[model samples]
Target: MTRSATARTRILNCTLTLSIILHAPLALAKTPVATGTGGAVATISEQASRSALAILDKGGNAIDAAVAAAATLGVTDPFSCGIGGGGFMVIYLAKDKRVITIDHRETAPAAFTPATFLENGKEIDFDTAVASGAAVGVPGTVRGWHEALERYGTMNFKQVLAPAIDVANQGFTVTDIFSRLTRENERKFQQFGTTSALYLRDGKALPAGTMLRNPGMAKAYREIAARGQRAFYTGPMARAIVDAVNRPPVAGGAGVRAGKMTLADLANYEARIRQPVASTYRGYALYGMPLPSSGGVTVAEALNILEGYDLKAMPRADAEHLYLEASRLAFADRNAYLADPEYVDAPVAGLLSKAFAAQRRTAIDPKRAAASVAAGDPYAYQEDQSIPLRPQARPLQKENAHTTHFTVSDKDGNVVSYTFTIESWGGSGIVVPGYGFLLNNEMTDFDFSGPRPNVPEAGKRPRSSMAPTIALKDGKPAFTIGSPGGSTIITTVLQTIVNHVDFGMPMDAAINAPRLSERNGAATSVEPGFAGSAQARALEAFGHTWEATPEEIGAANALVFNPDGTVTAVSEGRRHGVGSALVQRKGH
Candidate 1:
């Protein structure tokens, strides 16, 4: 048989196996427990959740399920993430009682320099910058998957990737949101022939319910499945990726010059496994992704400040005010000190110190907001003396990054919270000729105009707000939660944790509660539910200006472990996510 015929037959057989594995009932299923019971998966896509659950039902561990779910998301929710992106994963291995953080963040190519984004000493247009090869970073997602599967997963790389490969080969029904996003970025997609050919049809975006098949992406997946990470990072796939990125744009296309990426950059890439940053909030131990990600330090700093207040005793409005204030102070530090540790000396030890939070807390006025908040001297708190601080740069405009997050807990008590992104929707607008996947525009994540801590540097990963977090109580896993919304991600995660720990809300309620964000010096942005309510007025009374935005805070997904050892899973309903629990009742 021809190669195409063989692949088709294999996909058909896999589909049949998946149908039975996902839908058929087990003969000896465990007894049903309450909501917080059994293995569960929650994510932005329903199909992704089902894929994870199916893996768990087949005896795969949390790491296995997470990989399966993430892979599926790449195919089903291509705009958010794919093999072309990078991310962080926080995993709790129940057997070892250890927390591991994997930083698979994309990095600048070896050819990058401070002036890469500048021409004639002026920053290039944002649109032109993003639609070019210069914006593409050395992808780390494919390598990350292989690393996680080989080290911590119970299953092999091919096993975890099969579900996504099947989906890519057989095609899936597109959702309304997918169709809308495609239409919105139609002109951008049309700028690159490969992208236009893959995502658009007849010079237009595909409509909802279109059975989208990505055979090229399927082929890419198959290569990885057979040859492992080397397939993408060192072999034919790497060459295709480099060629696509380094190719000059066609005439009339909206893009900048080709980048300076090299094969060595791809071959030398490695996903670092680092220790998670840990802090205590109201007796619960919180763990967040460390440097290269500002989420953990920022969230921990805010939680430390909130710890000083008796939030449970305050009225709802006062509670909201305190939360917002704490978030503001935390963000101040984030803007000043957070960057890739390899490139900048991020004072991680001082940033999360409770003493530093205590010192910074003094800046907050219970009844009114500060005229302008500044980054605190965390080193002073650590050394018991003031140290010289750098002049703070103006905060960059909020990034409209598109990302995906998912949480999975297996029956063995292992859990994984993962967040991945391609930097923006339809990243770089340049697809590898035969790969059918978008390349991450992660280079734009840097401070482009001037020399700052996060300026483009060769081999340095961009600073990210993608924090995949886990909370522990009494040295045991309590909750796994995370979200996707650029800088709003830090505040979104802060609110969810507060809702659950202080307000005594269930996992679902905490995830779905109204959200607010105050990053840098911008006006506080509140969701419609809180915009015109008494809470907004109360915040206004505290000298806080506010703006109303549609309820597009963050897509937070969480898995909560109850005191009784039950597990509750919830996905932010606002973003059309779904939650599934792999529980077996007596009848089944």
Candidate 2:
């Protein structure tokens, strides 16, 4: 052959090889970016979404927009989450290829102990620990946002917080979720006069779209604006927390020993920065919040295991085979091993490994189903022993905790995935009057009668299912996604990523589409809207009990950046006016 002809043949071979790599199906999914300019913003509340867009328009980058949106969310969506609580933040910085995980999770009060919730040999009424003065933890949301802004943001604290302050001071309409949740907890709110006055309007829970202004919250923000994060952590705000929790007025102003929090707990609190739990599927990288939050590891592992299956050809709502098989592996690991990484040595690396996933995937039979599945002994694989966790007895009755989520991206290529919760709606239904929000009943996150580590411990963080996630393709961020659900946060987030990345759905479709999740042998919870008649029938045929509500699991949001330089963003439809936004440079 002529030298030129031979060279031409080699070039063609290289081209084919690259094409195969690019087009080949990956183990994990990648989102199809809908916008060509590659910028998008998403959040659970419309007010928050619009706030983020305003910041982006004002020349703030992704970090600024995210912080602004988060602060706005705290105001507009008070029943679900806020600065009064705590949360986790995951950031993808393109310039340095850095994936930062910030753990601003709430901490147990210093004076707390296992015995605090123990009466005789049995646990106290779970409600005793879950409600009232004792449930509140050391809030870290304020500090967490401040940390992110200091490190990556262009705007100062006041600038970033003004939007939220305005909304809280001037009022935004009460959302449907807020109204429903508030009414449900009206009696609890009325238990404390201060709490009632703040959340209730004319002795009734505020109606949806009622213009609700929280001057107290605005005052709190004012303090934050003037004194920075310290206002909330160590200064007057801290004093307010100390006075309120220790001398809570609910039971004639009883103090701690009577089951209340103290000053020391507030003063000593500090937020953490932890290593992200990372896993790869099909060349795309997934990163999420680490322990004290098992959501990240569980979601990462679930995706890793699913990658071993060929899901595209499976029947829609492939309940007997695909859903159950993938769920069996994921939830088993979640139950047997997942926990607060700070206290336990979880073998996350081994759990998500290709070899480990392959071994587990074999349990699935394409034609039938495994009657039951168990957590295969990790000992079978010789997983690293450096990680140590004392396993807890799984819960007998599923407790409920509600969470909130948001995702943001800027033209500068910074991404943020954040999830926060008050454990349940209008947490404890007990508000600290001047604080402008209800406190979280996060103590419920602990198993009432689990092993030593899983029980409530003084100064320890609770286990959480707040899974905030960011996915990267070819070393660039493809999207940021997260959701608000108690146990289902993991599955809702996992499937959304799969829909976008693996099945090639747009961001809106990925988040709004029907989804399903199973936890620790429970009946699978499929989104009422997402389940098809076929899927529902298949589930019933398999003797699975199913509930079909608009969305039984969660409310999710996602932002996908397309290769063609556009962005597509979506929020859960049931979330009620979940908003979408994009900000591009005028001439770009």
Candidate 3:
């Protein structure tokens, strides 16, 4: 961020803080807004945020705090994420002055084929596949946690896993979101005896404020803490996971399609260390997770396209229109060429090139939106021009607002931005019997009908839009941010950066603001705030089409590093029943 941008943010923060403090301290306490010196964390729940703060207070580093916080989310926010799922992590090691990424995205089992989700020659029912064992992949979160602590954390599983264990064993109050999600997945969850028993109270959603405890999850944590990640992949834990996937434990012994996962798929799973996706916007260095995740490239391409315009000087309506159009153009290419890199030879370098973005930008008109956006060819910008483009772009189906993201920062300048998920709320609707966590339906993320890029294959990871990202200013950590909104995740992160850098909103305000997501569709998905604003009316002259939805777009978590050596952490104040933010110290 520029110095002017930083100044504008601090001013807004101070003004907003005073207003909240003077008007509503009780309500303010419930909102996730914190600033301090030693460390900071922002997550989806107060319980998870405090768990991270407790670890930071014990002198644990940012990575350690992140793992501890994530584990707590598994207990309190079980519908979203846990050890049963997998995701991506972006970390900045202060000592190295470098950014790195851990791609722990779940991998398809070795028995998977291009037609794994197909019945006979036709694609299976999407809803049916989502709730069946066939949707489960070899979970990567357990191995991911182990790999993170082993490489960058100062503490071990025994120490970092303790807080989560406590939370699961002691129980936590069911918030509005937890109950709502339980109701949303009520039918699917009832199909599995173990899942229904844990989440449903007499086949009904638990009321808010009810104390829900998961002794099974706590026991699972204890086993992992005592024996480490290997035991989770090898022994009784492994057997339980496989049995759930293959036999499905349907209540009343009803039949369900079984998965092809075997003991070997679990044992062979490994977290990978890969190069971070590097890009630049407004002279600021941006680092994000690389492919098998389309988030980094798509968001980067959108930003790069926006950089073509002087948005800071444009009218609010014009800027918003440009933002929507840029997203549309970028997503066109994202849908076309991006997927699991191991399967598709994508032009990574070309997709991130400023030249490609500039070329795409030319297609946009300042006063009008294109009727339809088509994918652009980036091969011309590729260093290796010999590469050829693949078949026609195939659209992957994406849904689920149930994934979660969190950000952490330490006084040492180390930062971790992590986004994890189980695909949908109460994922696969099958919690391992006697184990408290839900299994992922991430396999359904793959395109159902496909012989194209992203088609399922043995050991191939599905493409994801989880973009855990960190930014640098003059070669040091500036901010760590991410969100959980399925495909909208890319738009949320991109717009947050644009708001902070170009629009000069403070970190909290940027996240709190309404959002618009245009993914090459005819209508842009717009939050109510923007839809009702005068700017939305003004955009009609530009041929912009808006599809307003009552649902909030994304629940983002972010931490901004101050030049004066302090950090500002923020989580959503209204979305997802409000989020949680905390810090080790209060002032500079």
Residue-by-residue lDDT tens digits, candidate 3, 1-588: 111211111110000000000000111254578776656667777777777777776778888888888888889888778888898888888899888888888999999998888778787766678788999989999999898999998998888889999999899998887898788778888789998899898989999999999999999999999999987899899999999999998987655789989999999998999889999888789999899999899999999999999999999889988998899888888888888988899888988999999999999988888766678889988879887665564442344554788777776777888888888776788999888888898887777666667788999998888888888888887777788877888888999999999999998999888887777775776776676577678888788877644356778888888888777788888877767676656654
Model 1, 269-292: lDDT tens digits are: 999999998899999888898989
Q: How would you encode candidate 2's per-residue C-alpha lDDT over 1-588 as one tens digit per residue?
A: 111211111110000000000011112112212232533555555566556666666677777877787777778777777776888888877687888888888888877776666668676654455456777777778888888888887887788778888888888887676787778767666666677777787668888878888888888888888888888878677877766666555634422223456666776777777878888877788898888887887787777678866666565555234655576577777667766666666666777667777787777665554444676445345456644543543422244546777777766677788787667666655677677766776765665555644567778787777788888888887777787777677777787777776677776777666666666444565654545566566665555554333345676777666676656565555544434433332113
Order by lDDT, highest first = 3, 1, 2
Highest lDDT, which number? Answer: 3
lDDT of 1 at 87: 88
Where model 1 places Cα greater than 4 Å from the true spot, the runs are: 1-36, 248-255, 383-389, 548-551, 577-588
Compute the lDDT of residue 237 as modeled in candidate 3.
90
- TM-score-best of 2 and 3: 3
RMSD of 2: 12.1
Clashes of each: 3, 19, 0
